[model samples]
Target chain A: MNDVYIVSAGMTKFRKHNYDEDFRLMVKRAFDYALNDADITHKDMDGSVSAYFSDHIQGQLIAGAMTNDYIGLATKPSKRIEGGGATGGLAFQAGYEEIASGNMETCAVYGFESMSHLNTWKGNDVIALGSDSNFDYPLGGFYTAYYALMATRHMHEFGTTPEQMAMVSVKNHGNAMHNPFAQSPMKITVDDVLKSPMVATPLTMLDISLMSDGAACVILASEERAKSLCKNPVKIRAIGSSSDTMRLSDRPFGKVPLLPNESKDDYKNLKYPGVHSFRAGRIAAKMAYERANINDPLKEIDFAELYDSYTSAEIQAYEDLGFCKYGEGGKFIEKGYSEINNKLPVNPEGGLIASGHAIGATGIMQAVYAFWQLQHSVKKHLKNGKLQVENAKRGVIHSHAGTGAYETVSILER
Target chain B: MKNDVKGTEIYKTDPLIKRWDYSLSYTHSYAQDSEFFKALGRNVLLGSYCKQCNYKYGTYRKYCMYCGSETADIELPLKGKIHTFTTCYYSGEPFMNDVPYTLILVEFEGIDSLFMSRLINKNNTKISIGMGVMAKFKSLQKFDVNDVYFIPEL
Candidate 1:
């Protein structure tokens, strides 16, 4: 297979947009910025892929074709990819495949979501379409309720506290203070997070990611083309995507009940057979690390940009991604291991919490942050005297959607 | 340098707004779902039993997820234990009117899957995981899916 490299990446500041700015305008801004960053004109592109979660909100179908025409790339073989919030990551995978198959020399991938047009309640109803309509939606369960169920179970099983979950929000909000592009960079305390109005049980309003309007783009090129056109290209070391049962009830919940003070050895011996915990993330990360030749993610990977759509999801990711053992995610965050200046910094750009979740834009935005981090150009993007990791060489980006139903993990190397 | 090149132009105007009132209807015809709902209309709890995998799905499923075989509809015991639960503090419309409502995931006896239902007649009763519960059906005013509720078992 041909090697793929990201020649350039661009992202718009994540926040609600004015009525005049629609998805098309956001896409144009990101597209132009990416072109400028890559030092290439639109005429040099062979094809493009557009990622957006819903045409229901935009009032259009086959939006990828429309986006191509709107950007004056109508003649190219363009397509739309949607996997709920993982749409951007899937689009990147498509662009990589296109170039790797020798079908295209360079491909431009972009993702955007314009949800500010609808009211919060209406927007939530539209986003809830990602759930299992037959089982989950009929019960009037939205993303928060689904995630709350998981959180409740995780707490019951592992003695994870609401305080630990709130710590995640406080830490990410602090990290966002340095990210100029963040939606809201206010410093928050665990007390504030706990005191915030509860959306669902155990999930306060602060525990959730903001729903915002934004766009992000990246230009992918084959290795040969990248070597000629770019000076510091970030190679796409490996990309893996996996999915689980759409219905949360169908997901594995581990057979053996979690015991207090269960050691890693006891966990291995007493754990139920044939039960896979966090099957989606574990499988995806395993495949990605294998392909990227990564043995120990915590030791080998320098930095990470995880999809923290919720505070608890980040904790779950810490365990699911093998950064820590199962049931240790809560303690992992409480110890401040994921802080920007720690041994391993996750989500230095504030993640979806502070950066805002524009669904389609989130995954590509993560890739952009990873690219900037690996290229050592993140200092200019910092706002409040935040220091970037020193001598960073490798990073991983994870995106998940539909309560662990769809997951994508990609490894990037400088 | 800017003499020949056109500078970026900003356009300001009142945005045109279009409103679409649309509703989509579908006649869902999953054989197992139909059977399950039909039984529910009669206040009977129906489950799908996958003999191939020896797994009984409390919620109706047409196919066995583990073994990929067709499942047969079977009657399930009305009582179960609370596997997990959450009291929703807020939600979207239709459910927004019923905020602070308790939703439970009940693990029925001899079933591999858990079923979700609202706990009716909660009446300040503190609910917890592993609490015994039984399914109770609403009056047969309509054959809707929201016709069943679970109450703490006596």
Candidate 2:
């Protein structure tokens, strides 16, 4: 089968519009951008789907209906897909699966969210709502608390300091300054992150990703059509997905990638012994490199868009995804390993940490940036006043929702 | 004397009037999300089983789905292992403010299934996943519909 290609990708600036502006309006903007980027019209061939976390958004079920009606994809074999935080990636996976399986020639994945529909606290309450309501939500252990428990474990064992955790915020916000779509863009210091108010011990307000309203869309097609119709066609090298128990408390900490039951218990904060969010990337990247036939991924891949819902998560993912050795994530960032000009540029698009977390949209948004980079050399774009990953021939996009409970890893190549 | 600083409130009358009044209680227990814990009230811990693959889903699903099989409901024993947990300092519900409580996802022993429940013992102890637990139900007077917890088997 021919390769699946990302012909066009674009996103609305991730910012909170009034609640009066609902999902439909948000997606109309997203469809306009994606279709423009793809250089096609809604009348173009094939089907479509909208990926998102609907239970947390407006409780109105069949959110896809809102999107389908807005983009008029209703008659075109549409449905909604979800996997908690990985919902966007899962949606991309389904759309890609359609093309790979020869069901459709082209598909569009629209992800939109209106967090202002529910304030952060209310939105969090809603996210926890779909979880085991009888057991966890009643105890008030939602997303923040789940990560807090992991932070406590990381500290107890690895000597990973809150300052180091705070560094994630400092580093991410620093990257956000260069990002146009980021909600909170400012130059913050480690001291600022540490001095910032503590939302949870070991996790300050700066440590978590923001809940902002936004939407993003990506148009995927076969390579032949992409090369002919689009300015650039970013190939879908590989996509990886994995799920663990509901909460970190239910998983056993693993010592190796996908090799569970290893001896050490350093990351005991996890309930499952052998799984990690980064492991998803490991599998995805391995399959990606294998499919693309590249060895030495660290050297071959020039840039990365890591899912940075929390700064600590990005650091941990650095180790888990084989970008750096374990425990060196803190050091890697300290020395600027993830800096735009460093060995590997991570979150050049301001990551979930820099830009606000838009749930289902982030996974594809990250991949879209990789699409831009693989097609347009970062060196060329950076000079053109765009955030660029220099000389980027291949790149990886990582996103995880709800701590490490669900993760999606995607790789892109030109 | 300490004075509580409070904000002013606006009150207005609406043109519509209602004649009926009703009382309904919304319970918050962070412990149960499905029939599993309520199953504990009947001495059975319920888990979701995939009819397609027979793989038990640790979390609940509206559709009993796996690779292909529809999921079915399965009954499990009350005893499970306390897997991992987080103690919440804030509560969305006011009742929880009385005590900062721990919410845990317990992987039931002899089964690789997980159930979200409260970690309760006669005496307070550090909560962890490996801690053994069995279903314990409080009297209906204190039931709150969420009063069942994983109490020390002793």
Candidate 3:
């Protein structure tokens, strides 16, 4: 199989657009930027894929066909992929495979979500469709409630405080000040996070990611094609995806059964053992690491772009991805390890928190940010003396959706 | 070119309005889900057990996820413990009227899977993990998933 490489990456500013600006125009602009960045024309592309999460909000279906047509690539082989928030990751994976299998020398992959067209509640309803309709939707369980359940349980079992969760928002918001493409770039403090309106118990409004309108694109090529067309191509080292039970209730918490003759020690030790476990993420990370030949993620991985849909989710990712031991995520962030200049910088582009979540575009946007960081192209975008990792060789981008049910982990190396 | 028409001659009309009313219905059926709902009407919780792999699912499943063998149905006790819970301060339209309500995930003693329900008397009682609770079924003219809830165990 041929190796896959990302030759170019581009994204639109992640924020609300004018009422007249639609997804087609957004994607066209992003595609143009990517082609220009790669120093290649559309003639080099053999196929394309579009990631669109929900058509309900757009009031249209067959978004992939629309995008491909608008970009004048309708004759080429094209398709659409969706996995809620992991849509971009899945689309990227598909494009990579197309090149790796030698079926196409180069492919264009893009993700976009035009969510600002709908009202807040309507958009929320569309997003809540990610949950199980029979069980979760009937009971009014949306993303906030589902994540809040995990946060509350984590606090009860691991002594993780709401303040620590607030720190995640503070750090990401601070980092956004340097990111020109961020949606809401405000220097917020932990106190601001605490004082923010509560969306769910133990989860303030700042703890959640924003629903924004944006588009992102990346051009993937075979090793031979990349060598001939572009310099500083980032190799796609490994990619893995994993899924769990659809309903949150079906997720395993690893609760030990209270056997009639079992010792008290066993009961005490087993109580709430997996309350904070992100089973899908752990599975995906393990698979990706093995394929990428990375055993020590915290040491080997120079930077990371985690899906911080919620502050608690990011804390859980630290443990799930084996960056630290279980229940040590809160303390790990407290030590300033995940800061921009720290040993392992995470979300130096501000992550989904301040960067804004454009659903389908988020995962690909993470990859785009990672590409810039690894290539040291992020220097021009930074302001206020923000530090970038020197000699950055490798990075990981993780994305998940459906209440932690679906997870994708990709490893990229310079 | 000189304008010949005055401002009063121009017609001011209301914006065009289009009422688009659409409804979608889905019919989903699985062996385990059918059995589970049937048992719900009788106020009994049904779970699936795989004799081949010794794997048990608290929610009904037609086939074992591990062994792929058809599982047998078993009735689970109503008593369980709160595994986790959260109170919603904001929610979607369907749940807007019931804001500030507590939703709980209950774990039965012998089952591995969990059951999600709302606490009926959340205002009068404080909620916490590991607290004992029991399932309470509503006497409804029509049976639905919302008919079941949880209350603090006596």
Best by lDDT: 3
Best prediction by TM-score: 1
Residue range B37-84, candidate 1, lDDT tens digits: 777778898888898888888778888988899999888889998877
Q: Tell me the deviation in Å of residue B50 in model 2.
A: 17
Best by DockQ: 3
Give the per-residue Cα lDDT of candidate 1 at A27. 84
C-alpha RMSD of each candidate structure in angstroms: 6.6, 7.2, 6.0
lDDT of 3 at A229: 80
Worst 10 residues of 3 chain B by lDDT: B9-18
Model 2: per-residue Cα lDDT over A309-406, one tens digit each = 77767777776666765556777777777877779878776778777777867776776667777877433423343567666787877766665556
The segments of candidate 3 whose C-alpha lies over 4 angstroms from its true place after superposition are A253-275, A381-387, B1-32
Here the TM-score of candidate 1's chain B is 0.80
Compose the digit string of candidate 3's lDDT tens values, residues A339-395.
887878888878999988888889889988888887777875454336466778999
Candidate 2 off by > 4 Å: A253-255, A258-295, A377-386, B1-154
Residue pairs of candidate 3 with colliding backbone atoms: none
